[model samples]
Target: MAHRMTPPSRLLASVGLAAALAFGATACGDTSSDGPNGAADITIVTGFYPAQFLADSLLGDSGTNVDVVNLTPPGAEPHHLELTPDDVIRLAEADLVITLDGFQHAVDEAIEEARPAAVIDLAPAADLTTKAGSDGLDYHFWLDTTRYGRVASTLAERLTELIPAEADAIAANLATLLTTLDAVDTAYRDGLAACEQELIVTGHTAFGYLAQRYGLVERGIAGLEPEDEPSANALADLATLVNDNGVTTIFFETLTSPDIAKTLAAETGANTNVLDPIEGVSNDSRGGDYVAIMNSNLEALRAGLRCG
Candidate 1:
């Protein structure tokens, strides 16, 4: 899928906002309204789309009386996301704040400042691997369906603690979500087992966990940060690896620039396709939600790897 890069000026603005938020310049405001049926008003503030999706699923529709808000806007990159003043206030007054800590500096600072009633950091909930050449934890564990299911189960348990009266409902929703996730896991394991090739060349290291889960090798041109530019030598090395591995496609993500992938593909005579990290939704996303997009990713991998 074609995606326009976040403009330089917009990125700069986001950085500026992050700086301002770090200094506590943003003013706090009121929290969300009370919950339905006289339950405690549960305001869930998430750092990005995946957490938000999980919260929404667990909480059910608006009738569930939980307010779910994702700090990262739709179609925006979750990394380096800037928290608006309104977001700061919401975080301050939220009942539960869920995030993949270390993924975004702005969100980390906001959570520290806000100090909500309860916080669930998905990074610790799920087993995390370190990015290559970096000591920091990889915060994109949600890409692996099984690991994501673990996180969801943990989140449901936490939500039950927050709202004891709704524990049964929360548990039921979690079971449904887990069943779907298991299906995805089965599909991935079965589909990738007999692939023609196990080497995946991606634009970034976001898929490390996914690759690890399914016993595939991932050669990421860039590190954890999608916007990081590749060195000339690194690009040349990636091109050589792609050609040596007989990689049919170079995978790019939905939110990052595909220029590097295109460049390497052009040099290696390979094609380019999207392997969504599902960090956030986009206007041109292959699927509307996590399950749909994941299925699409499965099909892409089957085709790209020549699975039998």
Candidate 2:
């Protein structure tokens, strides 16, 4: 179905608290103010960085054709994204909303309350798989370029269907995006093909998809969620793996605490390095966008893993 939004009750449901909004006016038959063929503007609300990147690429300089709002701000941790009432209303009023559910509980709750006309959950398109042989699905599928591309395809198709007037432009954008993703996949394949150490450990289990994709083994100090504290047993086991495998680097990510990884590195006589998960973008990020950050991560891996 083409995306449309009737003025939501303008009420945000937040853990038993409520914020109500009243819209004095509504656009005539369209949520977008104006665009191609006199079609209304399209608004897209993204859950986080990965979703925002795809939406930005899909729009592809279709300036004013579409507006994208990301709930998770740059430099903030997506795992702890706290949404304002205004954020919920934006989601409710957006023509389309794209997100990976369960990754952020607050965003998930907002989506349910906002009830956007069109919502694309990237999880299904991603075909999420478990990591470390655990029963829970790893939500960091974007770290795998192949999985990211699949979600991109889904978004392009949905957006085109929702806004036929912009289909041609969107298709062109998708082609370019697919090409970029393919190139990224190739780089990872070639970069990690051979390494001094295949046991790439990180601050968290965020790199399971990337490690699996490239046939590199990944172990994390934290569990799937960055905030999960590893038990003494888990830390000891990881230290053993580090020593036994002669691992030279202990990797940490941009958006989370580095103390644990740094501490482990000190304990194990390994160097601390960044292996970003690309969940959000900020000045501190090695690269400004997804592709650049992925390339930076590749360099980090190559250097840390001592890849030839």
Candidate 3:
């Protein structure tokens, strides 16, 4: 069984928000008529699209006051983006701040110092995430549907607690969201189950959790981060695996350059295609909702893996 890590509530008091209901207060606001901002809420900060999209789906149109803003601009790599002094100010007053840790060291520091009302640190294993190379825990947890479900439940419970009056609405929304995600999860299982191959070759090790959940092998051309290149031995092993297993597709991520995946595919006589790590959305994608993105992922896996 995978061990689940829960955030320590007391750790959030540094940001001047009550730890008991920080998520509801910061992200959804307090629903009490006497509560500051009268509970019809807004969201000010988020590190990526998946969490924000989940939050909006949970909050729904009834919570129109809720706003989701991407702290990292479109096409910007989260690991390397620097938050300016102005960005700090914007986050300070934010109701909710969702972020992946370590990669955005600057943002992590700001959160530790600023302590926005409710902060959702997406990197459960922040201590394990590394810039050293691709061999560490990748912070892209939403790529795995199972982990995404856990995260969504935590978000929903917190949002429900914060806005008790809207609990029914939030629960309804969350149920719908979970149902949609479950369908996608089922699709991945059913589709990948009949694949001609079980190995997933990719540019970065972003699909580690996905592979784990689905019982497939993930071979990356580079490390956890896109910028890191594979060792010559790693390349040789990948080539051997492709030839031996008859792996067809070399999957490159949407967020980074695919020069390496393409080259590997060329050398191995395998086809190359795009698989979304979904750190952020590009202009070409319709929008970065978790369902849409994951559906796209399903299609890619079907085509790339020759799913039956």
Candidate 4:
């Protein structure tokens, strides 16, 4: 299940073609006019679901008109998302494009080629942490509530800058979202502090931020890519670690196949459960939106770790 890595030359050529297609599409379907409400024309393009959720929450029911579009489809793995011609056209027309850098290479390239009016990259604002033993930054900052709160506040300020007329509403929504984020942070702290075990075994390294936040150790069978398959030695070592740590659960994600997790669980005599990475929402998700899915993840952690 390894992802096909696009070489630098091919990627550049693809970006060039996408830009040309985008320009042609824009020429035919140009609609940059403002809405009839006299509201500023604000079009938000997000790379994935988490960014989409944050942008939507920040612009909650405001009188100022805003159109937020998420490029990644529901239930799709976003790491290697290929941009469609229409998606490139949308990016080219965006007033503001929001993305987490390094999470989706296609979106990063599209934004570079499209050159939208404004771009808000959450990676730098979130002060993201890097995975241990890996030079790559952990792009999953939303897994840590405190870091995500910072990102949310930064997003609010950016939105205010973009649409000054809706500053008050954006500030109010920011306050509410911040409060909820704080509560989530507190819950993770309080719930995980008393856990009997602090070891988390997952199918991939998506939970590095979460494990770091909660002071737990994460043993990932694969790296950042969810579709990657672990080698035989890696699986054997993970099985041994699970038994040594007395781990009772092996965690899988919603967007990936559970077969590997089940196989590891069988080898280790442990049960398996879904510990979503919140990459995208799907019909299989325990709950909708970021908060609900995060709460569900907390519950899974508590149960898997035997928290008091």
Candidate 5:
């Protein structure tokens, strides 16, 4: 089990919107709705793409009236996000915020001080049981579509409680979202049912939850955090595992460098392919949205792992 961390719901008074207006967070809403200029003027700040995706889905059409802000920009690593003064002010002024406290240190600090109107920490809903890199909790729960679906239900229930007027719409959207997730789960289950290799080597340990759910083993060149560089001995051991286990493909991430993975693949005489963490979407990402990207990943896994 990962070291249990608490996500606070400290709902404090707003710190006035003037600070955010003054600072002008240029890189706001990378995966969000319109700015805080909607009809309801309700601001919802999501820490990154995973939570942002759920908010976008559950809000249904009411997203037009709600201002959804995502703090992390496209193509950036969510684990090491740095917030500016305006970002903190945005946190303070937001009507509701969805964040996983332990994942991003800077955002966690900002949330403590900014104290938005309502903060829903996703750790409780995510059920992060998988441990990685020295027994730390793997925060990439959304990669497993089933776990992501469960989190969606939790978010929908809480959102309906907060905004009762949109309850009906949220319910309708929840049905649709759940159906999609169910289908994705089925696809992954079937697609990876019979593969030549069950081990997935990657740039980092972000896929622990996903791998655990799908009954595949995961090895990373780096540790849990993307920046955790591996020792030379570790790399040599992973290369030997690749050769011994017949693991043909070395998976790299979209946000991080491919050098380490590629070098290992060359040493082991294996191939390299992309295995996106779906942390932040970008033009270079495999697909535009969650479902599409997941399907893209399935195809890559089947090809690389020699799935039957």
Candidate 6:
């Protein structure tokens, strides 16, 4: 019998407390206020790095004074990230906060308490009950470029509203953003359109929408939670899938343990490689950002999926 797993809240709390101690405390404060002469200080607390990247891009380098920070540590489960007391203070004082619903449970709690002036819940406010596009309750929306565009648009609008003077610039910025995203979409479409392999087997099920958009089948070792290990039956089934589909590559995420993937690759005699879901960048991410990570994933997919 498969054992039922606990949700990530407990896990996040445990990790968060430890990380808070290790990293000590760092709070992002905006000294410049909404005074007559100064621009409002903007600090965005994101659940992950991709969200932070999008925030930075939308806020722009000039006109908008924004500081973006990731709440999840490197190799941590995003769904389980809990906010420290310091994190709560950051959320309470921020001019605006963006959340991808269940992605940051701890941050959500703080938001409820703080009730900031502007809160953009990326969960569509309309469908909190339904699971995110795919993989069942997976909150990693940034991986899906299509859904990501919607969230990016919302972020752009919210940032514009927060800093009304930058509205025109924000519009232009969003236009540029849309164009870039379109290019990404085209890249995937063209790259994977006529692939010999239609199935993408990965460590975590983060590419639900990406696979859907490119018309590829996604088979994951674990469910939504990256830390969750598959059952014995699940592994056996996955092995069968690999053999049947003639799968030559097994993808693993950068932020999770690759042991299972390594074992599978050895058993199936398939090649193994890192296919980043871009959850969050560790301090040692080598200054990698959103575009760099996603573009890397695109290239890896093309090579691994044998889509030449």
Per-prediction tally of clashes? 0, 1, 3, 0, 0, 1
Give residue 120's error in model 6 in angstroms: 0.9
Cα lDDT over the full model 1: 0.80
Instruction: Return the TM-score for each candidate structure.
Output: 0.86, 0.88, 0.79, 0.88, 0.88, 0.81
Cα lDDT tens digits, model 4, 62-122, are 8867878888888997878988776775676677999888888888888777666689989
Model 3 lDDT-worst window of ten: 1-10
Q: CA lDDT, every prediction?
A: 0.80, 0.82, 0.71, 0.82, 0.82, 0.71
Off by over 4 Å in 6: 1-40, 125-135, 283-287
Give candidate 2 regions above 4 Å deviation.
1-40
Kindly list the per-residue Cα lDDT of model 6 for residues 133-170, writing each as its tens digit.
45457566677776778878878878877788888887
For model 1, residues 161-232, the per-residue Cα lDDT tens digits are: 888888888888899999999999999999999999899988677888899889898888778878778899
State the local distance difference test value for candidate 4. Answer: 0.82
**All predictions: root-mean-square deviation over Cα?**
8.1, 4.6, 8.8, 6.4, 6.4, 8.8
Worst 10 residues of 6 by lDDT: 1-10
TM-score of predicted model 2? 0.88
User: What is candidate 1's TM-score against the reference?
Assistant: 0.86
Q: Which stretches of candidate 1 lie over 4 Å from their true place?
A: 1-40, 61-63, 132-134
Task: Write down the TM-score for model 4.
Answer: 0.88
- TM-score for predicted model 3 compared with the true structure: 0.79
Per-residue lDDT over 175-194 for candidate 2, one digit per residue giving the tens place of the 0 to 100 score: 99999999999998999998
Q: Model 5, range 1-308, lDDT digits (tens) per residue?
A: 01112233332323333344335555444333444342245668877898998898888587447767789988898898988666776677677889997999887877777666799888888888757446788888899888898899999988887788899899999999999999999999999999988999988888888788889989988888899999999999998999999988999999989999999999999999999889889999999988899999999989988999
